[model samples]
Target: MQRRDILKLGLGMAAVAWAGGAGRTWAAASGGSVAAGADTLDAAAWNAARQWTRTAFGRIAHVERGGGPAALFLHGFPLNGFQWRGALERLSAHRRCIAPDMLGLGYTEVAEGQGVTPADQVRMLADLLDRLGVENVDLVANDSGGAVAQLFAVAHPARVRSLLLTNCDAEIDCPPPALKPVIDLAREGRFVSEWLAPWQADHALARSPQGLGGMTFTHPHNPSDEAIDMYLRPLVDNAARTHAYAIGLDSNVLAGVEAALKQGRYPTRILWGTGDDIFSKASPDYLAGVFGDSRGVRRIDGAKLFWPEEFPDLVAEEARRLWGV
Candidate 1:
């Protein structure tokens, strides 16, 4: 079947289930009681499981699961650690999974005057790991988080065991042209009130073609109502978060990191969604060429920018391959 057709079928099934009052919670085959949509975690559980750590950056919010070697998951722009809920559930058995909300985004309490650039995010992750007593970690990242992952690997090459990067900012397209309008809105400090506020008020609108679902998700109703609330509430609740997204995208933070990336020997794997329009198609190829220990790029047919949240199985599979687990 065509990808669009498959998506339609899934949406139809979900609608029918909702109409029939189907339960929202289910036991994942991998283990644990996951929320609807296969591997999702409900809002209440996600909120309750969060752990706060005090760092020089701020009071960082993160979720931890599993045991053994450490694996860190970085979420995309405007998203929190919740983006990796599915991957954490699946890969926790193999490695300790830790997903932290980036400063200025999610529920992380960022102190005033602190920067929210990719470089700053890299430093925040370093401090987070140090406080947690984790030395080296396998990195899994998507969207803008991918940019931070690159900076982290270069800044602390010894601390990265391997890298699994999905569609996001690369060296050439740090702030892709498609993001210019959003960046402009951020510059004006109107992104939260003008864009996210509507979505927070109307769940269906957020899932519509005009919002995040249409822009980044394969499924029209994806991110779910619960996820939409979880991801957007914090940003809209605070006025300070209005410009953070733009600051992070203001410049190409990955400009000079390519040379260092080529010199590093950390095993790397690139995953690109063919349907993503925000980033260049050549990016995955460019990244694969730059990494010294690249395992090549895997293209997900018809997937969009946020495919990591939709297809965590693929993320886990590639992570395991890169980690040689």
Candidate 2:
């Protein structure tokens, strides 16, 4: 089948599945349809709703929905706020959902000579919340964003109401072996042009056996054409964005974070995808061990690194449970 046909079938099947299954689960819990809101926010709608906040780091681009205690969603490497669109769509009804494009990725503009390490991302988030008047937030993150979430939780325990982590960099396996090739490319400042540009240019390549779909997503044509453009265009468009992108993956920024995380008694839960190749399978158990108040770990069988996007229903269900909403 052609890629466009696959996307059409996927969309139709997804709508049916959500309406029949997850919608019922959500209705049982909250007395409402999970598909109630403006379903999926495509590139145009997402861009229309985009807002910016100026900070010391740079102009931070973010999108928000709903109205209540804040819930912050973080994306993985080479992706942006768009990664959490599915989650934000479902959970926005329960909490004020915010998804920000981290510095060096997406639309977040970095200041001249600024760093985009995990540590730096943590500080940027704090500043962002402060500017937005969000005193605290329920944190949800996947992939590299998970590393930033961990650091943020430890650094500002009082500012984090709860934590939900997906497959990401852990202290025990900081900068896991799987990232070596990507890291090498980043180190040489060729990652964006050499890797992401092609995926952005060709959606089929992105969903092929050798691309993001084969590696991270469970479904072929998972990210869609609009998603591919929105997620990768910025990284490949400018020299500054590319430089910041490479800087973020240059080193093990998660070093020394474990000792700090273990001391915190914050409410935490781990959701790990067993099929992920980028992170260690033992990471969830390792993270559960480190957190003083770990609720538990939920292993998602056959799911890959980007399962949160693929399985937003599960993400929202677990997030609601963790937030006690």
Candidate 3:
């Protein structure tokens, strides 16, 4: 019998640069190199999304745009930075929008045993910023990215100017109770091959409610073929990359996060969706109470897990309002 049958386990789930720097001209600063993308600050393009070698995790990839205040974007679990595409474009006019594929996800390369724990993720960002010569930034994070973003804010408050946390794992409800089954499979070390292979085989089925992870998003009745390929291409066929996805599932990131937020020195804004089934409303409520002083909390009615995908413009507007930019 094949290994697939041996274990009747359940299925599982889951830049750049710019000219017009120094607020005047593009000047490569210390830390990392910044490539010039365009001639004007308002017209900078982020579509190229570049990659660089990071001392911490081999090659790291990220998308960037514009100039002025820096806004760092973080993506979440089982998904790459692509989720922030629409939002990045929307915010590109005023902010230096940036989104990096976290640790082993997206097109970033990873060694077999590289650690992607929330702690490691924090260090990775700090190093990346140091390379890019970014002094501070507004953090816009969703899903699992929020978890790392929280830790990051606590560890390096000076680097983060503001925080915008969308639906994500908060407090102790991480992986959210709904996703515990999937998390369990990841922890068991069988999720990648057993669960994903079957799902990737049928792209349409993978996007259906009865499909692999179809239950995660509330809008976009069906995930576009492009979306599936963009998000899952690396993991579906590669066992090493698949294992990389499961690398630090047991870390309790929220243990220190709440205290950090209560004692936080930077402004924070919460944007939540009331329709999410994987992450609870309570998580956002707790975050709102803590980060409320910044801009209070704004909830999206009838939106689900991937509200950014459904309403990127709305998120961009709220971000603008929250930051007064």
Candidate 4:
């Protein structure tokens, strides 16, 4: 079957199953207290949604809100800020949450014929923050965002109040064995699509039959069709895939992070998902060792790289505790 057809079928099945019996169970599993999609701050909730112009970096589509201290959410590569829907719902209640579609991802337009680099992406983020009138912020980042956040913190220490990382790759002397091959492939500018295709296909297949085993904290009783649709939407196009490859090939994110830690400017905290297959638990340990006595590392049980989706409440609770929001 074609990719789109397969996604449609998966989404249809997911919707029907979710609408029937699994809806209540899914909600309960996520944390009975909070409502699904209740806390998300979208274009509808914000006063205005605008595209931020950063001369060297290009335009970044972002949303802004007024209130408490600024909290900027930097999303992982391949996925857009939509991944933060669950976390945003809880966070938006107190602080103003700024979730932007990074360069070459989501609604943000990428520069034609130019591959997005880690340095350029970080610069765009800096520009986005400045354009929004945010002086300093509590940084929340995941996956590739961790590297960008680290660089931002190092470059602009005064602009960051605290750091919260989830399933991210931080600068450590000894990196995980699992990532070595992928990192090497990325560095070589090889066929990252072919390298990542198997895992991506497996993830798609896992949504059915065998189920979300080992992928999510709890078995998804009723995974939202819309959620699945949103997740798969980006992959349907070449622009998204090309950017994903660009991010994979960029080695500076890792190297830049290492350089930043050596600078010793900002305080950092790491929240890792033990079940994350992308970046192994060893990555966090390596980060802890690099930070030495100053930094903190905490592990989340029954969660994977995509912890926000698998255990939204747990992520929110942990962020709240760490950031004191």
Q: Tell me, by TM-score, which candidate is best.
A: 1
Selected candidate, larger lDDT, 1 vs 2: 1
TM-score of every prediction relative to native: 0.89, 0.87, 0.81, 0.70
lDDT of 3 by residue, 252-278 (tens): 667856766777767788888886666
Cα misplacement distance, residue 257 of candidate 4 (Å): 4.2
lDDT of 4 by residue, 70-134 (tens): 88888765556666655565666667888787776666666665446556677777877777787
Clashes of each: 0, 0, 1, 1
TM-score of 2: 0.87
Relative to the true structure, how large is the alpha-carbon lDDT of every model? 0.78, 0.76, 0.66, 0.56
> Best candidate per lDDT, number?
1
* Residue 154 miss distance in model 1 (angstroms): 0.8
lDDT, candidate 2, equals 0.76
For 59-166, candidate 2 gives per-residue lDDT tens digits of 999988789999999987778887776687688789999999999888988888888878889999999999999999999998888988988987898888899999
Off by over 4 Å in 2: 1-40
Model 3 scores a C-alpha lDDT of 0.66
Measured on C-alpha atoms, candidate 1 has an lDDT of 0.78
Clashing pairs in 1: none
Model 2, poorest ten-residue lDDT window? 8-17
- The order by descending lDDT is 1, 2, 3, 4
Question: In candidate 4, which residue ranges exceed 4 Å CA deviation?
Answer: 1-56, 64-66, 173-223, 240-252, 256-259, 262-265, 292-295
User: Which pairs clash in model 2?
Assistant: none
Candidate 4's error at 153, in angstroms? Answer: 1.5
